[model samples]
Target: MTKPLPPRNDRHKSSGGFSLIELMIAITLGLMIMTGLVTIFVKNSQARTEIERNNRQLESGRYAMNLLTEDLRMAGYFSSFNPDELVISVNAPPLGPNSAPVTPAMTARPDPCDTTVANLNNTYFFHVQGYDYPYTSAALPTCISDVRTGSDVLVIRRLATCVAGPTLEAGCDALPNGAPYFQASNCFQATELARNTGSRLDYLSHFVLNTDITLATLRTISCLTSFGAPAPAADYRRYLTHIYFVANNNVGSDGIPTLKRAELGAGGYTIVPLVEGIETIQFEYGIGNTANSAKIDAYTADPNTYNACASTACLLNWLHTYSVKVNLLARNVEQSPGWTDNKVYALGLKADGSANVFPASGTYGDRYKRHAYNAVVRLDNPSGRVTP
Candidate 1:
């Protein structure tokens, strides 16, 4: 054997060619490329998640706002009473037996006070006996003036400059015959008194005479004092009314499970659920007039006093209107894509609760890689109307 000819030196040289420094450089470059690709993928995913969350928030806000607008616009609107005032009823006598009778006929008179048989001391009165108009025909209109369902005999009352009193003697009393009412006005051949059976009072408790009704009962009644024997010296004060909207607050850690129905009269206002992921809602009121540019202000518990110019008188001084601003904040409770990084957004809202500036943002979160939104909205139905 020629002794393997001293292993080829060329083979050894080939194996030793690559230096440590060159190997290190190659490895570093590969790692850098891999790192860049991973970062790009993460950012893209986060962005997509945020967009979806935002869309959901926007949709929910819009729907809620629309419903609120329609209802609020219809405030104070009734078919019978003028657009400015609404007529309602009371329970007890005006002041007392000597004070005023406040029967159905006396209170339900159409205008503040009409002299004719069809007319009475205003179309409103105070009848403790309650009004009992028979639904003789199915064709009868649904509502009687502002009062609809419920007890028929109520103390009729009105809100106006012309009509006056909680007095039973001149206005509230339906009749001096000790029957159950006093007359105020007459329209054409219309008579204020009705000749029903005496014993039927209990059975007829829920009935009302042929009367007018409109869209919703007047929320308040004011027993005004007057100089002309309850005529109009001291003006009629007001009662309060309010409405609340909410989802089925019954949502659990699992999620919202049911729909909520609106409750008509007043009672325990059901707590409503906001959007599934929404955390809060902020509101702003325009201190200026509806027609002009408004100066947005922080929301107050009592919007009327703050934005409505301090007092009822000042509030009503406007052209009968003001504007509203709203802000909605939504969150990804699930952080679906693990994109909970914080991002602050500055945005504006329209009358219908839609964000106009859209995805505005400020740096946020530990990674400084998240985004958020701030919205400002305007309310269209602000009538600058006094809460009274």
Candidate 2:
């Protein structure tokens, strides 16, 4: 205790803390490392954002193409009934009295939005109808609005491939209410089976294709054979009519171009937005010189105009369509930083750098990137049927 107070001042001086210059140098190095880390993080974030944008554009484009292909392939698919066998029926809904037999025929073009049984009957002739931009009609259909002026509109009509119930595609009916349905008869009358003239009117008399599924008169098996017992209920499929086109906006002026469809539902035509960022859609039809032939004789954008006849009695131009070439332009959802998109997207036609009707200038002078998708899809249901 006597000498503890006089501790060595020289020892304390030898173990002194860092000098001010050394401390400043360490701070500068730390700051440099931190700045490098920050720069790396920022670059990574930007790259990730760009990748996300690109993925969305690609996925949207692919999904839209698949959707169109699926529906187009099924066009004119009326379950057991062949549309080719449907001859001119004066007893069609429009011509005859209200008690007309429900045979398939078209007095006029069937409106895609029209869910009425009368117009539904008209699907026999109007399957796979398409109207290019500069539509032959003065205006677009009443139910479809905000259709991108330059984009194409395609109408696909068919019955659901599966039975209408809680499961299966196209139908999606837990309990069918007022939705249109198509049912085929499993039982054939002796008179019908014997003649086999293959006439549609005679054949359709055994089936029911109506908007009401709750009709009690529908029968799958012969009720006459049941003899006061219950007859088996025929499986019902929802009737699907789709008008697909591109819209200028996805929501309230969100500025996102989208692929949309007017679906024939219980409440008439329900407009539904499909894939977004689909800026344009176009189509080229491959028509055959002969009816129900697979060989393509001519290709045109306006099928009706290309294959017009002196009389309206001939087959509709759309009905002769055997293949369809689809073209879609998909744009990125977000603008890239300091990016300039001056690319010409050739959706269809010759790639001579010609100006397209979609962009009007052939090139999109914007910050968002765009890609074009194309497919030549065969209309299987219509093309596969070889009239014997």
Candidate 3:
């Protein structure tokens, strides 16, 4: 009657939970998959970081190059006449009784050929000058910050291309006859006049009256007519002074080198940061022999060579400059861990035609990545007028 107890239920016993060994194998496989996924994620992150760093460096370098190229091409540009032939006529304030009719003091325009006129000590006229690497503030007064040791300084002087209409409100001020006021289409704003009171009258020589406007009605001095009948607003321009240099740091003590510009603004000279991560800058001038051929005859790093007094044979060489070769050393924003830069980069030829190399030691041995950029910007204003 016990009836074979219940034929043993073997099926239920076999279908119980998994064994310890099986659980261990499943866990091991899951851990292996997770390890692979983590490795891939880390590698992708590193790649993205590297790409971003490179792009940033490139963008900064390109911007700096473009800015300099535009300015260099326009160097020495006046509205429609050669600046060399122009002379600034400064009027002496009307004095006691009859002060000899105050024959306006006539001084030649800033000429690279004249040392006394082109000297920075004058400060009234715009002059183009440069200082090679390792120069001191004493040598370059416009360099306010501590510059990078081996970086060059470039000074550009020119007139702005923008023109103002002959409207009175556009900086034109009316004065009584013989009162001695600047007669130009555009007058400096109140702020500009206040900031540049010392040289305000001298800079007026940069402007000429509209040909249609009679010079007799404007109380203009003979200097205006010496150049030729003044042209209209379409031919007028404003003076511009720019100084370029590399600063030791960008923000605070971060050690991020930057390209800076000190421009003559409405409020006088203002220093502005243009591009960051530019560790160094160098420049070479291509002097052309206009008397013989229009092609470049020689290259020099010293702007003084173009100075009339610096080299008697090369006097007026600045006017013959056809091209400017620029070299910039660009660097990454962040340091690469465990990386060392051990290569010397050649920028260009020195003043004496010798190879100019960065880190003369043959190795920088730093964590930051660097690149050298070379560009030859033709000075259209100077070269186009060269006579073969």
Candidate 4:
């Protein structure tokens, strides 16, 4: 009876479901919110990828810069032998039977991969050398098979800081028999004993620089060769020759510009990849004005002024290099999204007071982000031995 009374207000009834207009508006709002969320997700993902690439690029560039800079400081370390000792013999006039050896004609650059004993003997005077934009007539050794075009190559020669063998130190392993070993004479030979007028460094023939150690009769610090008793065998060190350059590929033509090191070993020159994404390496040499200068008087991009270096003079020019400016152009391994490397980046300094830019042109028209790392490293081993 109560429900029959309420049926009289049926014209004022409330709706129990959404109308078509309200449903359409609700669906449109839902789609807009989903689209915004998707856009945010995409932007975040891209931002994350860009951050990773930048971090990797930064690591590679700084590591390379530090490596080159630190190694450059250790360029001419040969245990007890200094370039100062070499300077006296090669420059002074012939004194006697144990005087300066006959020097060869000057070549602008020596082959970094030349492991032949003869070649080693000839170029041992130049402990450090660099080649700028090597190609055609200025090509490096054939051992360097993948040198990137328009990049510089650096050669560093030194001895192991620790002792090497015949006998082994606690940390270092003995070098194989055929590998080149060096033993400089702190104690002189019988020929040098007769003419005690000069120092041990006076004779150029006393050092064991070549691989042929059969007649390497140089002695240790102990001058124990009493008339008949044999002198103690010298503790020789592993002669290290490293050539650093930018190679076109890392492994099997990957197209990743890598900093490759061709290190001299028992077998010969062995190539190995170091830091990757190092697109270009350029060096500016800080040349000292005098033979014994410990400071940089002038800087030159090209040390191979062929006309300037003649015979022993050539050795002097390279020996006088007191410092090196290392410039490395490093880039991201992958292309950045919505990015263009149209900006000109300066690495080193130019003669006209501007910065030295890469690609040899105005800018790099590419998508990869790049950064330049540079450091001026002093040649401590060589420059320290000289008076400022």
Candidate 5:
């Protein structure tokens, strides 16, 4: 009787959940899948980051090159006026004493044949000069604080393309107090400097123009005559000076190198950051044999050799320069993790096709990647007009 349990329902066995081994196996498979996905995601993210960094570097490099090239092309431009014939006469009867004539020949100084070239002012009539390895304090006292060591400096002087019309014209209204102003043939306006209280304007401030297609003279108007009549169309422009160099750092102590430009501004030269991650810059000049043939003959990296001159006759050698070889070393914005940059980078021409390594001294031992950009920029303005 005790065994008389309801007939054991063979079809309805006790139901239970998964076994311990099955649960463990499912968990293990899930964990493996999750780990693989995570790995894929991390790798993809890292790759994207690297790609973006490289793109940024390339874009910055291109921008730096374009800026330099554009400025170089416009160097020494003075409209249709001949810079060699420029003779600045600072004469002001009201100022009492007349300044001695300032000719291009007077601006020539004996070439010191050293890094001191960077300290020299813009003297050449066709104002274009460079300093090789101009980072030393003695060479660039004004810019040494920001300049990167072992880098070249380039200077360019020219006239602005735009022209201003007479101050009395419609669009060229004179400033307050009957101050003298300038106006180009196209009716552009340029106000006179109020701070330039001196009766005679500085020779550097005057803009020489080819007004009648036959004569070129400094455009000047007296304040008394500013409202009398419209001045003849002045086809000339304003003077411009630009200096370019590489800075050791850009923001704080981040040590991010940058390409900086110093441009003539209202308050004098103003420093501006052009491109970031430019570690070093080098320049080589190709001097043309103007005496024999107007063709480039030699390339030199030393400013002293390129500007070698004992007198005005020798100074003419600088005008023979036809082209500039620009070499820029650009670096990554951020440091790469667990990476080393130990390779020697060639900048330009070498004796045995070697040397010219970057970091010139000790190994960087840094995690930053670098690349070299080389470009040969032809100087159209200088090459076109050669001094006899």
Candidate 6:
């Protein structure tokens, strides 16, 4: 009696709807495909993030290097001083229309092994009461603290040195080429006070160190009475062999970060920020011929021409240095994750074996990246020669 099922349809002969097995299989395949896609997407995102980070670090490093190199190139270039080393002194005598009838004092000297040796006395050297906290307000884009004064400036000077110790020495007198100095300590110093005879810049001078020292507090010894005296008069009236460039770190009332510069006197500091994020600086001296470069491993307190006399000599003779090697360390103030390893970027490596490394070879001192750079900066900008 039961009704017989209709004859199977042609469609039914084919795959019909799906069997449970088929349905399960299809679902499994779709899930597997989705998992693979998601994994690819995640991996891609991570890779992109890492790539971006590396690129940023590389760019930051290059930018910092460019800034530092440019300033280093101009190390001792001054419009006033025809030859950079003939820097005006604390009591540097004014030159007549012609740089003649040289002051007997600057050229006075003791005999040297070489007859051609210039007089040490006649060499005019600049002195600084103390270096400015920030040599120039224009150097910085933004400032966090007020311009440091007096002891604070001296503290920075003391902290900055080739090596550490409390005693103020000739080495601590000024920050190497680009460091800072304080006020009270700077002006009150025996040399600064000694050199600061009259309001005129003749006696007062700014101090410059031959090497880079850490900036915290400065230790200073007046120019020697003679070349070898342990301590010289504050003014260096007794004797002064050479003057070094002093660089300063400071913030101005205008809220600009800057590096202070004082060229003994006539040439007051003109702030030029070699680079931003530069918390400190160090230097390695370079000397030798064009064929092969040589770095003076030992720190030389003075690089002025070794003229033995006390009075008149050509400042240019001492300015004969042709090359220099500059080392710079910059820090990012913004808190951010730093790189895991030292990176060598393809873009910045020069043809020479030398390569500029990024993130330095240490844990980030800050949460953000801190990069250090070392470059053999040619002092002569026009000609690629190493300057002393």
| Tens digits of per-residue lDDT for model 3, 136-174 | 666665335668888888878666555432343345433
Question: How many steric clashes between backbone atoms does each model show?
Answer: 65, 0, 0, 0, 5, 77
- Per-residue lDDT of candidate 4, residues 1-388 (tens digit): 5655444766788778998999999999999999999999999999998999999999999999988887888888877776465453345422112334534344345677778876675566566887766356346767787788878888898887777755678898777677887877666555543333355544345567766667566677666766856567677888888889999998898999999898898769889889999999988888775655577887766566633555545556677788988888999989997888888777676433356777668678889999988888988887887765
lDDT of 4 at 382: 79
Model 5 Cα lDDT, one tens digit per residue, 1-388: 4776677667967778999999999999999999999999999998898888888888888888888888877876665544333221121211114343322233343222212212222242435667676335676636335788778878776666554333233453222221112222222223332122332233233332222322322334432236765445454344466778888888767788999887653334567888999988777777775453448887777534454545433334455566878888888999777689887777885322235668777768888888888898887776666534
The local distance difference test score of each candidate is 0.31, 0.71, 0.60, 0.75, 0.59, 0.34
- Cα lDDT for residue 349, candidate 6: 28
Ranking by TM-score: 4, 2, 5, 3, 6, 1
Off by over 4 Å in 5: 1-13, 85-100, 103-124, 141-144, 164-231, 289-293, 311-314, 349-355, 361-363
Give the C-alpha lDDT of model 6.
Answer: 0.34
Candidate closest to the true structure, highest lDDT: 4
Clashes of 2: 0
Candidates in order, TM-scores: namely: 0.34, 0.82, 0.70, 0.82, 0.71, 0.37
Please provide, for model 2 over 269-337, each residue's C-alpha lDDT reduced to its tens digit, 9 standing for 90 to 100: 888999999988888888775644568887777665664452333334566678999999888888988
Candidate 2 has an lDDT of: 0.71
- Greater-lDDT candidate between 2 and 5: 2
RMSD values for the candidates in order, in angstroms, are 19.4, 5.8, 9.9, 4.9, 9.2, 18.3
Off by over 4 Å in 3: 1-15, 84-128, 167-235, 292-294, 305-315
Higher-ranked by lDDT: 2 or 4: 4
